[model samples]
Target: MTAMRSPFRDALTTALLLTAAVAIVAAIGTQLSGGTQRIIIDAMIKMIIVLGMYIFVGNSGLLSFGHIGFLGLGAYTAAWLTIPPSIKASLMPGLPDFLATAALHPLPAALAGGAAASLAALLVGIPLTRLAGVAASIGTFAMLVVFYAIFSNWTSVTGGQGSLYGLPVFTSLPVAAGFTVATILGAAMYQASASGFRLRGSREDAVAAQASGIDIRRERLIAFVISAFFVGVAGALYAHFLQVVVAREFYLKLTFITVAMLVIGGMRSLSGAVAGTAFVAFLSEVLRQAERGIDLGVVSIGGRLGLQEVGLAIAMLIVLIFRPRGITGGRELTLGWRSR
Candidate 1:
């Protein structure tokens, strides 16, 4: 007898369950989940981060060690736009005199911020996408460093090492959850699209793609621009969620964590995105919890195990030892299961 082909059935259940769980949590934040609600909110934020990683690393088959820079750009852009003129005058004493006099709403500012970072990505992607493999990787890393340097020195706009606050908390649990669901669904849909197929084909074999009349550079540019747009949106989400923007938020460490999520999640598959994002987001929270302190009958460790370091080390070790291909191993969880 032929065994049933229900491989994705189980996975689809898991994805649906995850989405349902998020929806419930988002709907009942603070009302339930008690003190853990903030943690759930943060997990949703990380989901956005992982989704950003999925576009470039998953679809394009390129390792971009620098997309986090878009986060910083978006953060500052939104922060600048949301900040009241009176507040801006105080913290950012030297903000462009024009900006000090300008008035903008938070929602429009979010869009503007996203567009700003996407434009930057387009400019950067135009040349960088031409390089493939590890070379492209290096180029993205350079972009991150360049972005970081600018944010650090461009105090007039970014507030430098200082914090830029005053953003209204327009983004909350439900909004974030809605976006997480959308990004996951969108990324999965993108993978199955004709354009995504062409991009994947180019990533797999540029020479072959060129022989088949595919423009390798154009594909890369397209993927890069698209990736940048989402990343920027993710940044705006982050900015609104935090209600503050700072330079240190998307430093090299966050970049490493983002890369780790992609590598572990299976950069080539949508299942990998969901699995990797959920795993990393939830695990990081657990680490945070354990770091705060685990109670024991006899004695409590008092939570101070330096959870950040421990979490990263353990995450890397787990990915390397148990499953080098990351979660889902590049397989996607989709509606295909229903038809099959």
Candidate 2:
């Protein structure tokens, strides 16, 4: 007979395994060219974002399309703090004196970005968390739209549809991998926490959860804020990686891809989040290469534009058709052993 593992231990094991997997990928990327390394870094960043979504969407069983808005908020915040004051003055002339002149290190600026997103989540979640089902999803989408509109039109702070350049490029493969590991561990820990369980209970059966004295709304709000923080951090990393920030990049296209990654991986499981991201990232890369044309020795075959999106959509449909609970069937990855 085997002793049952504690939830904390299980969560730790899962996080460690996932971190090891990410490390392996990062190691392989180092052997490849710089472009490939960038792709790996970008994928790890996306993993962080997906894990953030998993924390809220997986635990609360709520679908949110607005999480990327928090990413945008984080990116802009990092830009505000880290960009040279001289650049800020010319690019964003309407900025307040403090932000205009203040330049910070990338690490703290990333944390500040997370904090900014967390605050935004807290403010929006107050009322939004009260809604459930499709209503809540729509509300989140509306929030995304609102964020995009504000970021696009707010010329002073966000640069108003213009790309914010001159950001110090500090996101390397190791940096992204480290953050990815931290995010995976954080997500696993959160899923094992009391708040996480309560929120999941509400997701499974709201009435029963509420009857058991669970404050569903409050739990949801907590998850929302926490998830936003992780995504915001990813946003800061993205800003540093690209050395540029564009409002449009944080809008609908990103919202769709991130949500799709979560859904395809098994939104209810941490392992699924990791797996889905890896699978989709690989698939997207393949499709992108094919779009650039594949040489078949005798004849070259090329794919049209939008191949990546189309391929992802088809892949998602096939996965949903066969595995309705996502590729992991809503199960965490674990050693194949039974506890007694």
Candidate 3:
């Protein structure tokens, strides 16, 4: 049977398409306030993370608990490349012979970081893919922990707990929006590719897919690399976006937030990526604002407690209780035009 397209799907797709367009135009429009600009920028960065999720989790039905490692890898890679060569020598002594010898441009550095992350994922994916079910899950989690440990301990390269600062902030709203567009198109293309189909097949039933001549390990690795690459890109943006890079930024907690986006949006769906990211991203902000408490002028309370903890718990509860399959439930963004 052909893939069914519901009205809801059409509407969701159209809305996101319009949003991408509007964001692009706005990016080119007159400069926006810093806070407003930051919101859009944050959304765009999150777009990359969500798209990465859509690739591996969506196509292959794999749940990676440590995908943030790619973000860490990308951030560190970019930091090393983009940082002033003089700064590098002082910060990262006894580094890779090539790194010490070579200097990098921002664009090239971003590409290199993405490539490095994908390569790293490839190496790691080989052995990890051999395990099935929860074994794979735990293996990946361990991988994340290991990566975090390395980042924390590898002072010279990553700068350890201290933030990697002094990155020239080249990431503007327009650039971020462009990246978001690219991310959407890339994820869409991956979803429709032959390899994607094979990966999905393996995801649905690895044994059956193997019987049909599919190399599950190869397929998983491919997905892992692709996902890692995008996540790496997201890391580049995040480093520049915050004007710094830190190990904690890509820890298990970041993984949890990203996983929440995938799970609440619906695993194995492109539309779900957008849906989950939009809803979760926006909701998180709202909860944060609520926790912070709006200024009434008359009085203000709840200063001692940050709403983030409670907000996160509530968000998790809402998703698990009401919409278990996630908000999108594996849908696609199509044509549902709504005028404001």
Strongest candidate by TM-score: 2
Q: Between candidates 1 and 3, name the one with more favorable TM-score.
A: 3
Question: Which tens-of-lDDT digit does each residue in 83-142 have in candidate 2?
Answer: 999999888888888999889999999999999999999999999998999999999999
Error (Å) of candidate 1 at residue 310 is 3.2
For all the candidates, what are their Cα RMSDs to the real structure?
4.3, 1.9, 4.1
Q: Which candidate number has the best lDDT?
A: 2
Clashes of 3: 3
Superior candidate under lDDT, 1 versus 3: 3
Model 3 over residues 222-293: C-alpha lDDT tens digits?
888999998988888788788788898888667877888888887767767777777787887887788766
Ranking of predictions according to TM-score: 2, 3, 1
Candidate 1 whole-model C-alpha lDDT, 0 to 1: 0.75
Native-vs-model 2 lDDT?
Answer: 0.91
Model 2, residue pairs in steric clash: none
What TM-score do all the candidates reach, one by one? Answer: 0.88, 0.97, 0.88
Better of 2 and 3 by lDDT: 2
Q: Provide the lowest-lDDT 10-residue window in model 2.
A: 331-340
